[model samples]
Target chain A: MKQEEKVDFRLNREYCKACGICTALCPKKAISADDEGKPSMINEEACIMCRLCELRCPDFAIRIGRMQ
Target chain B: MEQHVFDRLMRDDKLPHMWCRGCGNGIVLQSIIRAIDRTGIDQDKAVIVSGVGCSSRANNYTDFCGLHTTHGRPIAFATGVKMANPELQVIVVTGDGDSTSIGGNHFIQAARRNIDLTVVVFNNSNYGMTGGQYSPTTPVGAFTRTSVYGNIEPAFDVCRLAEGSGATYVARSTTYHVQSLIKYIASGITHKGFSVIDAMCDCPTLFGRINGLGDGAKMIAAWPEKTVSIEKAGTLSADELEEKVIIGEFVNSSRRSEYTEKYARIIEEAQRERADLK
Candidate 1:
């Protein structure tokens, strides 16, 4: 949960259909949906790189990787 | 330099795809690409063949050797391609209507032949491109344009059909389980003989609208609750599992010889006989 911890993520907002699967399944509560239903990482520090969001995004809009 | 995955894999010119918002085709497409990347397949040697339908459009967006073939004939087309060049990795992307309805014969025949081809059927339950008509895999009692009174016919379990038809590898996954889909797809591609990945996708526009289901995203979000893992599915009775989608790898067999391999053996024997006569 360090502030400097590197948790790289990329979301193709254009492809996102705002299904909220990632937000619902994220164990760390790292992803959340906006009013429009589009998802964004709300807590990068909480993301233990579990990749639930990246794996469960039905639109293939999210990609999570560790910053090298 | 490590290139961005999508940049290296997708056709940039075809930026925005034609699928409707919330359709699971994009998810399945990405899963296939990720599988290919994970397996380290040579892109130059990979060929993607697709039949007519929303799923077939995947060939148009992928940066690989692609063939958009006639409706319900991708399996047949892919069979020939694999036979001609056994070295190339051939993958067929097809819809439920294209694969199991109009192309049903080819599907079973390909599996029976044990051809070395990876067939990915995007089962959105209805024909999305031509309006929401019930397809071969559409569940009974589901509403569709053609099934106004409800789809009375029992749906085919695509994985079970493939397994019965002699496919070497058979697996099922939904758009909700992207990781499992990718893993199964990669395993299917690596399997020697015919491999079938039945990927359940959500057609929010056609299937969802006609069935009174919500939009694309909602339909996809509902999958986890609607489907059960194959292992867990066994614990449920037939009545209990009636409406639930079963997801898992149903078969993986290395015993059967691939069509191309069998053909090669025949050719070798013929050559030896000719040499003996000479």
Candidate 2:
């Protein structure tokens, strides 16, 4: 994969409420939730950069950006 | 970084808003902020006014000028502020109950006057702040705490009501349609006269739990199935459109004169008459 095609995805732990919205909304299923319901990027390479998770995140916990 | 754009506009000290998990108020607030950015409006000149409700807590999170007014009175206070200084761009962020129940009269009156204010009503269908009581916008046959046997009252079509009351601009959008929601809100912000953007939100904790609508994601996923764009609705028959919520702009006209500018003209004429009489 090209370096420029990579997307920066990170969940802010301090801001997250473990609502599981990011994992649920990702069309590509690139994000996954743990047993505690906290979300993390499980497939960074599969991300299409659609930004659905970031835009629809109720808590604004998920931040997605393009890597330079 | 792009993160600073949002950070500079927000009071990070108030991080992690007090709303329940998966509440749509946060999404609505974010859309409003993004719309303000889209309009290129001066942050210092804009004011966010809100009435009492779960959605009314939005002003506390922003760094711009804000007024967390009493229940059902945000529009009245915003009117007073606009009348005093017409230069300020006023935006009202209110809930369904806050705008339709106690503030119903003010809401209609503001539209009638064609004031230069953008009113955003976060319609969660029920009164989330007061324990899922059936609000004026709550759909009939829906279960609410006040309507244990299901709500018999018909819901208010917010856009139609605003258009009927003479709002120059009116639109309706759901939280799931983030891009459209942002565009509608941005257009509302730029509109000169009274604009009402009815934001259909989800109170997942109270309303959804009581109605068996599943969780946050499930409720949002159902939006596309429940609503149809106005253009598409025109092609569908009445029977086919039954029980479907129509989304998109209903009215956008700038024919009427704005309240503040007209008032200023009246004042100037009165002062000129006094000078001639002297």
Candidate 3:
């Protein structure tokens, strides 16, 4: 059986402005961005669940929730 | 942005606000929503007013009772709203150009009266909406469309102006300090008298492009190096503090009665004195 993830990092693409702040500020570099600046999950294994991306994102498009 | 918060505070139809890419308006709006939510003020009782500017358009995004007034008149309109219905929480969202240029008198007068209004000034230094014209808060030697050879005029500090104009609560925070910005705005909302929160933000497409400051993320990254807290600011020499933006609350006091409350008292006394005539 596959292991469950400890946390969830969600991005609402419809609301994202492609500012790339989350990708730039992510401590673990787990998030990457496309050419136009839209962010995407790159390596989920290295996640620290710090949620700085959610806190600092200008557009409020990112959300990280800790799982029980 | 929690799902619940987004659903509760924002206008879903307006998803992905029209602000420029990497603009600081979105961050400021988010901070405001969180702050208002923290204060637990009823959305109906709270009113948001704004003037003409990129920042002033913040009214269209919120789920609060709002008034998008004409250029440089949101504060005046808010004053009237507060006077007519003292029960409402009046919040004025203004830009540096709107508040310090044509509306300068209204901004200072509102503070002088100690009115119950929470004014959040988005000081991006340049007029972003109007082709990056240098505004009253544009730092000296900064490049703008109008300042082709760099600005020669000194910048006006909004926080200092608010403090000197008798504002009961005054705070200075950058969009970079999202957590502290939310706290200061929340404190301002709960405070009884005039509150002025200067939210210094980046104007990437305009201010940044004109000054060669790179994009939005780079400007936000520079916030830490450019800003100093009040405690640290006191220790720094004038020369050292020249370019450093000071963050933190500068004033918090309730020494004087709120303008609306004072007006209500006068109305009561007037009614008593004219009882026989009625």
Candidate 4:
């Protein structure tokens, strides 16, 4: 549990169905919505990289990441 | 169809595979790639292990490390690969006959031991690659080349089998539900223990001709409209279900320690016992 630990999320947009499951499950509240109600990252700095968002997203849309 | 991810996931260079047109294996392959790309697992670090069957040929199309092993033995090979290098992300792709019929014993052991490997079974019910043999998952009374008069045996419910055998992560998805397949595949990859995705794909060459599905499209369309959530699915009667083929994750729990964790604990205890002797 180092402060500098990094996690990676590789989002494949083609697979994403725009389900908000990830947005609702993100522990850090890092996921936000766009004009079309699609989930987007509003605050990457606050992310703890727990991956709950990635795991919960029914579409496999969002990938949580600490490193690009 | 000609201008989608399917094209990219497929080996157009190797087009005209033995499989008939509209075979669900193609879509399942695409979903597998999407999940791999989505996880960002280094392709070099990823290994695709497969057995002898139509679906097993998938290892050839993927650019990552691949293993085409003996019949019904992909799990054995996959287990070795994962244990040898726990860092390597290992995946096993097998057909219904290769996985459930012949490799049934290994399947149960892997689930009970909870090896850290992802197992994707191409459950088309009939063994297309091997002349339409009825497999372990073929519905009872389903006709096949061998079973001209419907099979007398009941098919195994793969998700339920895994759940019963102690798999840490178990799910069932079909080619018709592309998004759900990808989602389940991704979750299976991230899960720390043995994960099985029983992918129900179309096999027009065999299952179609025998079941009178006519072709692959109608066969794939035969998949249920809505897959029940694992929690709610248990309550409904199998006959009452629409889209008779259900698709969803049945289990995802990290409570039971994976093989690696258990081995580590054993080693630690051994070291403590040795030290006490000193």
Candidate 5:
């Protein structure tokens, strides 16, 4: 059986002010907002790891890791 | 464990900063650190100087030789530091109020001198630290604590001011455009002469709340609507571009001699003349 591909996303929720910039700039539509407007991974399988969300995050809340 | 770029540059002991949630200062700070990392500059040779204001607090988070000077005096202090040690990379971080309100003269004079210093002006359009008072860069008709009836004073386009004052490099960008902002900042740092980056940041807590601009997320989302690229702005008429923030490099004069180089040359010539007389 093939192993499932996985990527890690570290979010510092304390720092995140729910700016949604990452969600808006993500080309793969992999990030979405939760009920509190904070960002969350909606489709990790589709993530391209472009790091756009990580770079554009105003609060330094998001970090993208390599796929495994 | 792989450390984040900021983690290596920032003073981890000061983790969890005091800036309000959703403030764009963090974005600007990240861009600066990223620029420094990309330039491969020696951290030991870098000096971060900031003036009194919310933006000035950035020096507290960075691990470099940081100096939090008097209000609106970062440029003057940075200039002295650059002159004393031309080998050091002096970067000035200041707020709209600190840069344009009280430090306006120093800002223009530094540009006029063409000193080798990189200045990043965090322009949130109001005095964020002081309760959202309208600043010199505040757009006309913007509501603020002091401008309850709407601001009547015209705003100063920081890029134009720097260019007019003879800065060798000048650029503008907002927090929303992270890539361009980082690129411009890196270019500014690499530039040999006076470089100015007028970064339009969002002061969500004070400016947004008072202006009805919603939360930090909404304010950033609306940045695209308020800003126009320099290339696109060129094609638009004055009326069409009203109230739009222009983002792009306005000047880059690598041919101009930097202040320290010129001064050093004068000193060298004087010493040679004295030696000949001896």
Candidate 6:
């Protein structure tokens, strides 16, 4: 099996307001909405590390990181 | 040539600064240098004035005539530099507290006068240095060291403030978006009148720790997306607002001539009148 790249996503559920700002700004659509309209990761491979999703979140709940 | 400029401007011994890993201030600093390079502005003719803060350390790194002035007083110093030597292109590099808090009055007054200087406010939304205290740009209900639970005060809209203050050119960008930030800084450098460039930086030490974001990279990623320019802000509806924060050129106009130009013209006219009288 090929080694999967580690996706650096720092999600603070308590701070997350489920506003979807991250999902909207994400160019790759790597983020999707969960049943409760809260953002979730349905796909991680498409994340381009643009930091747009991270920078725009008002709540400061979602954080994207680099591989170690 | 680019490599030589970079080598001259940077101190290799300062290889590692105190800013957290992936901090945006460094990125903004690089962009500022690139803008300075693009303009081919004479290094000797360029002066960088910075206020005391984490971001202000940029003064030490750049090769230009740099001054790390008192806290929140970079604009005042820059103003003096320009007034004394109108030929030099003065740039003010300041932080949230340095630009919008203690130095806010100077900021407005400078713009009102249409001074020939570029003001780059590193808006990390907190006082990263001397502990993470609540700053003027900290969003309402956001966490801060002072606001243990959440920040209650509203944040300052920098672009709007600059535009309202009669700044000739106003722009906003985040460190995560490097390309946009470079363009904005470059444009501000070229602008004759007061130009304000708000570079949203990451305060991982104070802001990130309190807000639950790990460090610089995570905090930077938390930046909200930009939807539209400030010029088109009124035309957009609530539904069209994609990003929580709006970034880009907010205003660009040549309504009033710069302070230097007006002063020179006035002096010249007065001299001609005196000669005619004689």
TM-score of each: 0.93, 0.97, 0.95, 0.74, 0.94, 0.76
Q: What is the TM-score of candidate 5? A: 0.94
Worst 10 residues of 2 chain B by lDDT: B1-10
lDDT of 6 by residue, B139-217 (tens): 8887887988888888888988988988999999887666788889999999999999999878776787778777554
lDDT string for model 4 (A1-68, tens) is: 34455455556565554434456446687777567556777776777766556543433345555552
Question: In candidate 3, how many Å is residue B89 off?
Answer: 1.1
Off by over 4 Å in 4: A1-68, B1-16, B225-235, B238-243, B268-278
- Over 4 Å off, model 5: A1-5, A17-20, A24-27, A35-37
* DockQ, all candidates in order: 0.42, 0.70, 0.71, 0.03, 0.56, 0.04
Regions of candidate 1 where Cα sits further than 4 Å from its true position: A13-21, A35-37, A56-60
Q: C-alpha displacement of B29 in model 5, angstroms?
A: 0.4
DockQ of 5: 0.56
What global local distance difference test value does model 3 have? 0.90
lDDT of 5 by residue, B175-240 (tens): 888889999999999999999999988998888998899877779878889899999999999999
TM-score order of candidates, top first: 2, 3, 5, 1, 6, 4
TM-score-best of 3 and 6: 3
Interface Cα RMSD of candidate 4: 11.4
Window of ten residues with lowest summed lDDT in model 5 chain B? B12-21
Summarize candidate 1's per-residue lDDT along B1-278 as a digit string, tens digits: 58867788988677577777777888899889989999899999999999999999998989999999999999989988988899999999999999999999999999999999999999999999988899888999999999999999999889888999999999999887888999999999999999999999898888888887897657877888999998999899999997788899999989988899999999999999999999
Query: Local error of candidate 3 at A65, Å?
Result: 1.2
DockQ of 6: 0.04
On residues B85-172, what C-alpha lDDT tens digit does candidate 4 reach at each position?
8889999999989988789999999999998999999888888887898888888888998888999988888888888998999988
Ten-residue stretch with the least lDDT total in model 6 chain B: B1-10
lDDT of 2 by residue, B1-278 (tens): 35544676878889888988888888889889889988988999999999999999999999899999999999999999899999999999999999989999999999999999999999999999888999999998999999989999999988999999999999999988988999999999999999999999898898899899988877888889999999999999999997999999999998899999999999999999999999
Candidate with the greatest TM-score versus the true structure: 2
Deviation from native of the Cα of residue B107 in model 3, angstroms: 0.4
Clashing pairs in 4: A9-A63, B224-B243
